[model samples]
Target: MKESIFHRLYDTYHQDVFQFLIYLVKNRSVAEDLSHEVYVRVLKSYDRFEGKSSEKTWLFAIAKNVAIDYFRKSSVRSSRTFDAFDWETNQLVSPTKSPDALVELNDDMQELLLALEKCTGDQKMVIVMRYFQELSIAETAEILNWTEGKVKTTQHRAIKHLRELLTNDTVKEAKSHESK
Candidate 1:
């Protein structure tokens, strides 16, 4: 019975948990290992799940706790490094007609990723889950075990920070292009 429940839960939420873990840890291998650990823990604790929350929300809560534990233990090590791209240089050298013409907007993506890396773990989690993963604000709040108001405030701050980062990067890129 426990095994069946575990399988069902895993089948239902494995991808969501894995993706959340990846965004949290920023290391693919570590995220995979942590994701497995989360499932194992959940299976062991299945009886404790009193169904106060939706299964998805409960699972996300577990994932968030697991990530916190991992970070606490590995506080000394650098979590991950984001490489920012030189957009102006890339635009000028490449045959692409204009920076705006590039699909996926790699430069903006890189800047956003870098800014995300600089955020507090809580801020980063909220931003990634809400914006990047497209989870509803209520869902993100439940998953993070936070109040809806707190989630909204954190998300607002994260977006403000991201906008600042992007604006700064764009200005720098323009100035560099003008100098060249």
Candidate 2:
């Protein structure tokens, strides 16, 4: 593959691919390795890419497959949980926010991530692609090899499940505070 073409592809889709893998595995190092593998596969198969879909869609499809393969190989150990990410101290900072506000925001983000962990694999994939990666429904369907209706249904169910989990968490926290 020509260096320019490869560079363009990397520049256009690398971050999206990395983010998708990170969301799937909840581990930055694993995600980075998978992202590199995706690029390797793309370079090998670039000539076979027919123009049936947009390049973005094609790239995402490749990424989704790579992540799936990683999951399959590590299924026995896949139950590993995400470490607590310090959102307030991460790059998503707001200087105007008070310390209390920053801590609240971090807590909320952590809660949402934890809630997402309870979803089934299919539901989690749709949720990450649709919301976290900000892909459109059509693009998500193409990447997942599902019908548009299936994508919509999966996203709806995932959102409902997440709401239930987060609500339960909130209730439990409230009860604990009351008991305190």
Candidate 3:
């Protein structure tokens, strides 16, 4: 409730919460709006926070719930594409590559993001949390309020689905090239 504690929470967890919301909603603007809402709710409920979970994990759980609420209220999904560049690295996946090679790598990463879009919502969440966000399985399970087994199963299935989607895309591209 205190302004200083609220500011501290925003400073510490805003980026992580925003990233999770962006992955969930697929829109930066919506994520930004939702990030504000997450903090607002956190401020309102701060006194009730029992501190059973780490603050970061607690913030993510709130973010996930806020995203779900947005989906429910709007009954529409944002079609914004994922930005595939790693935020922390501030460079493409392979920085040492030549310009053309870097472009190719970017294309591949974008294609992978598109493939991820094809996954079911739960699978997508599991993949983003486990791989993209680099959260541990236990942490992801906590965020999703799922049992660890459920998180593991969803992660396994998501990976399998991603492989299939990427392989199919590669085949389609190859076929197109062959025809060309």
lDDT of each model, Cα atoms only? 0.73, 0.76, 0.73
Candidate closest to the true structure, highest TM-score: 2
Q: What RMSD does each model have against the real structure? A: 9.3, 8.8, 9.1
Query: Quick one: ranking by TM-score, best first?
Result: 2, 3, 1
Give a tens-digit lDDT track for model 2, residues 81-176.
544433212221111223222244477776776677667777878888888899999999998888999999989988998899999989999999
- Colliding pairs, model 3: none
lDDT (Cα, 0-100) at 161 in candidate 1: 74
Better of 1 and 2 by lDDT: 2
The TM-score obtained by model 2 is: 0.82
- lDDT per residue (tens digit) for residues 30-119 in model 3: 778889999989988989888888788888888877866675445422324444422222211211122222244477776766676667
- Using all chains and alpha carbons, the TM-scores for the candidates as numbered come to 0.80, 0.82, 0.80
Clashes of each: 0, 0, 0
Task: Give residue 14's lDDT in candidate 3 (0 to 100).
Answer: 79
